[model samples]
Target chain A: MKLWLTCLLFACMPAWADAPTTPTDAATWLNRVAQATHQLTYQGVFVYQSQNIMAISHISHLIDNNGEISRLDALSGPPHAFLRIDGSVYCSFQNKPSGDIEHRPHHSFFPEVLPYPNTHLNNFYQVRSLGHAKIADHDCEGVLLIPRDAYRYGYALWADSTSHVLLRLIKLDAHGQTASQLTFTQIDIGHAPTRAQLSIDFNDKLPIKQSGNETEPKAVWQITNPPSGFHRVTETVMTLPDHAQPITHLVYSDGLATVSLFIERQTQPNTFHQQGLVQQGQMLLYTRPMGQYQVTAVGAVPLATLVLMADNLAPIERK
Target chain B: MSHLAYANKPHQTDGGHDYIALISAGFDGELDDQELLTMLDRHQSDINASCWQTWQLIGDTLRQSPSTHPSQLAQRVAEQLKHEPTVLAPKPLRAMHTRHMMSLAASVSVVALVSWSALHLALISPHTTQLASSAPASSHAIQIAQIDPARLASFVAAHRDFALSADSPDTDTSTQNTAEPTQ
Candidate 1:
């Protein structure tokens, strides 16, 4: 009888483990989706849509002993391609090589659309299982992340049932409208992509924009009233092209959504400044002119959230 | 010249308020010879020059003309003021018009392509299989306000770096070879 029970338990374990019966189980499934995205080698075409704008891109991701390498080519709109080897990114626009490759601290794209596990999104987002469905003829389990407050947007994620790879993601606005979406039409998981498929010639005298050598400057500005659950992540001072003065950049995140505040001294007296709010797809930018300084806050959050943070930003008075 | 005569007009007020009215009328082509000459003379003043440029930009925007950067407009206006005898003449202004029309044209084409693909995908793509419960369509329309597109694009690019931090420190760097492609 014991031998018979052992066989039955082993046979049913796969199905039992995949199904989420509680909220905690749903969170676990999300964790699995995050893990599969980075650990497995995948190549696919995904469609990104936001409001009236739509773009299709082909992405090839490879994970080997040398770390992760991904090449993304835009199949629609303007001709452009992005090659990411770990944290560094290279770009080619209109078949012309980019002059500099930017080294970012963290970067994410379509399939790799999840926050770090340590972010503990469950604190701000209520994870729930939306059951199962088929996407691109592959069975997928759906998970919904509903925001606990109005400060942040929500997300609906659908992961492959067999591999737990995220196949689709829909970002929802505060009113539950689809703010933006990314869905894979076809995917090849676990197949190693050739080196040539993930390679981009940086040997053409293209300078690498190094971020590791950048030193963190003293924090001279502070956001007095950030929205709920949002906290400062990183701050740095860097010289942007065309600007004579260095810009102070601060990054804030609520795990999923991030907001960047840029402050620069106004050197030219006649420089025309752009003020007020601007919307680009799911993102919002708010610019406010402080005394002798230009302050701008850019993020995927709502206009009110940005306004609240931008209005309350104050410079630290040094003795 | 006519400007010197208009600058000495008895009825002209010393305050910038009178020039402001003339500037507004100049945009509508309602200024008479005397008023037009007076407006041109006042255009040299720092306050009046700024006022004139703002009114011109507003008129161009209302007429659905190609959008130009405010700084660019200021530079062109300053250049015309330096070389051209008549700063407010329509011929000089029209010569420098629509410097950034190509970007606007590109934006229109991109929108058209996106609309076409969205319809095509919905009709034929197998990935349209909806999984989540359908919510009521939002009635809200996004309003594109007056802001510098180039400056906004830079901010958006910077924000993207932090927005998508997918790789976690806890993420296992070791590759998983057991999974197979679902062909």
Candidate 2:
């Protein structure tokens, strides 16, 4: 009887241990996704699709004592690769050296799509779980973020049930159409990629055009009526290779989405004189001539949001 | 929005008004054989040729063809001129017969096209080509220009930098430490 009871307890203990301990709430799952993105060591091949375009890429992310390092190589189209180490991004195109090592904040790509845990995502997005599904042979629970307003797009995310890592993401338009998608077709978790896999050799002899350093300039332009939830994040003046005059760049973000506004004086005789709107995949661009300056706004938000920001842009008196 | 109104307003024109109309008609693909002859004849004028080159630049920029460099275009134009068969030149229209209404319409279209082309050029990048390959075909298919890939890159790069920074670990409000994968 003692032996039978001990065996029975051992069999029953497996059932207890298998019971669901994973959080069912979407916010907790989102937090887990964010944490896994930054903390985990993983490598995978993912397919990114937007409208009629589809691209396959390989991504390898590793977390070490020096912090996070990642490499993404495009497996389709023209050869392009990006190496991100902590906050810096280095890119190479057509196997040619991209001269500048840009020092900027992290830009989330596939598997790293969640906003930081501190963002007020709940205020702008209704987060809910869409149950479980199998992705890349891994059982994943889906989290849907429905936008509360028309200003921003919605998102649906699938995170691994056991590892809590995000495996797939779908960007939804205002009408709930899939505007873009990124899904891993194969992935290996909990293993660090070899250093050789992450190395980028820039020994090519192609002439590399240098993107000069950026400098912060005084805020002379202001948007009087920006869309709600959107706030200015950074403003700087940078010299573009083609433009003779410096362009003032301003970035605005509503937690998940971002819009960049570029302002430059119309010094050239052939400056753009017409106002127009264009859409490419999920991105929208609006440009209008403002007095002697031309303003161009680009973002992945709705056209209304871009128009509102561009129309409200006004010059402010510096104190 | 007010800029649209400003752009639409008519402005004073120089002696190149008639040439501008012909250039605009050529861009719209509405030029006839005779009009083409007249345009080719007027192409000798510095102002008309410059306007023609500008229009070509806009078209080339929209097409994003690498061979559309200004110097290459000039060479191509010279080559085509060398191959042209000499023929009787068409009679030029009388100054009084110049269509002012047509000229005005052409001017407006040119303004719209210039503006449209500029914005398209600003937005397009190599990344766009990689992503826009699957765009649905249409009669009025939108052309993605490549006037300044570097500028577009800067905007996109900056935007991504800031957008992702919001959720970065440095700014995380949660007290949970960045955890390792469960072995």
Candidate 3:
């Protein structure tokens, strides 16, 4: 009887040791965040910090019968508003007329949210849960995504526990130093935004206009050898009102961060030129003469990233 | 705390270990007046003196303590003298064996004085060939030279995937392009 009792106790040991609560993994949590950011309605004031540059913006996102409508108004500095209706983006500056609307999917002004769900993000980044944190007065689960390779930087992401919306996003450099941080100071989840909050009403006296062709043309220029994982996503020819000639813009992305390359023909000899690389905030700019054209690659990626893109800039050859 | 915790069994027979522990205790200010006197007496012997130094060095290394000992300056002078040719003849001093201590002190002081003079001369005299500053002057330039604002704005405006800036509300509409289309 004593032996039988001991055997029974041993049988129940594993059950007693097992924990009842199971926290969500990083991938599932991230997927939920990507969904919540697009599907839900939220309004918040977020602060973006890049080195010494700190800008606060009030953002409101509403999903109506038509589609998603988001508005981001700069709270500090000169007043500026970036309003989006479905896929069209409109801009307004302080004391200036509203800018032309463009037909393109808007960028996530908030860092916590990414526009696309990168299914293969796990292949490049090893995601790990960093326990719990409180952000914007809400309990959040923080996750650190360390890059598997040097081609891209890492990210420290935090999602709201209840809604799974991203509450904070920190871009870490190759050396693990914080390159930039974007966090919401205050946020209201599931809040029905007023029409005024989601709308951008420009002054009647201010002139409003659109610039450039309606659609982006095929990319004439191509990166001969782009770094691993980076792919050219969008190519467009932009004709700014002030510039004499149109500039060719090519965008490359590694799932998360983006690099923008601008190519323009050197119409006249530049007497004064500041060439090489210039880093401002999280953006790194590398400009050099590419034969007859001046190529400038700008992005939040490492200097090596821009250099790689700049070295491989060439006109695409048609067979 | 465990390091400070006394050994359960004291092995007085182990001279080196006992002395090291006592020296460590003396350094930690746990030694009483009698124990401190005992430590001082042990410090006088050559073997114990060297052992005390080694133990102190180990403790300092473990604590990551910056060495501000005056002996460092003497060591530097000694090292400088190793490379330098003997200036003052030790031959005359070597004959007087009774004044050996005085002779050693005199030699050390002379080396120290010579090292001091060499340092002073290096600092006072300017070099004819000036190497460029290790840090480029432009790198440290505090004021960021402003490029053509219009040109920079145009480039930035054009390069932006989407128009993010509301600074210029003109027909600029490319800042939004920076954001990639959803998967």
Q: In order, what lDDT does every prediction score?
A: 0.63, 0.61, 0.59
Ten-residue stretch with the least lDDT total in model 1 chain B: B173-182
- TM-score for chain A in each prediction: 0.80, 0.81, 0.80
Model 3 TM-score on a 0 to 1 scale: 0.58
Question: Which lDDT tens digits does candidate 3 get at residues A135-206?
Answer: 999999777766655556667788888888888887776456676778889999987576564664542212
Q: lDDT per residue, candidate 2, A1-319, as tens digits?
A: 2222333444345344334444445456677788887789998988877766677878888887767877777687546566666555555565432233332434455667666574566776666555688998999987666666666767778888888888888776655666778888989998867655575443332222224547777777788888777888778887665567888888887767788898989886447665776555466777777889888888887777777888889988766
TM-score of chain A of 2: 0.81
Give me the displacement of residue A213 in model 2, in angstroms. Answer: 4.0
Docking class of 3: incorrect
lDDT of 2 by residue, B57-172 (tens): 76565445667677667667666665776343354332212343345445545655566565334222112332234322322222333324455555554444555321211111
Q: How well does candidate 1 reproduce the true complex, by DockQ?
A: 0.06
User: Against the hidden reference, what TM-scores do the models get?
Assistant: 0.58, 0.57, 0.58
RMSD of each: 30.3, 31.1, 17.2
What TM-score number comes out for model 2? 0.57
How do the candidates rank by lDDT, highest first?
1, 2, 3
For candidate 2, list the clashing residue pairs, or say none.
A52-B134, A116-B167
Identify the leading candidate in terms of lDDT: 1
Instruction: Provide the TM-score of chain B versus the true chain B for each model in turn.
Output: 0.37, 0.34, 0.27
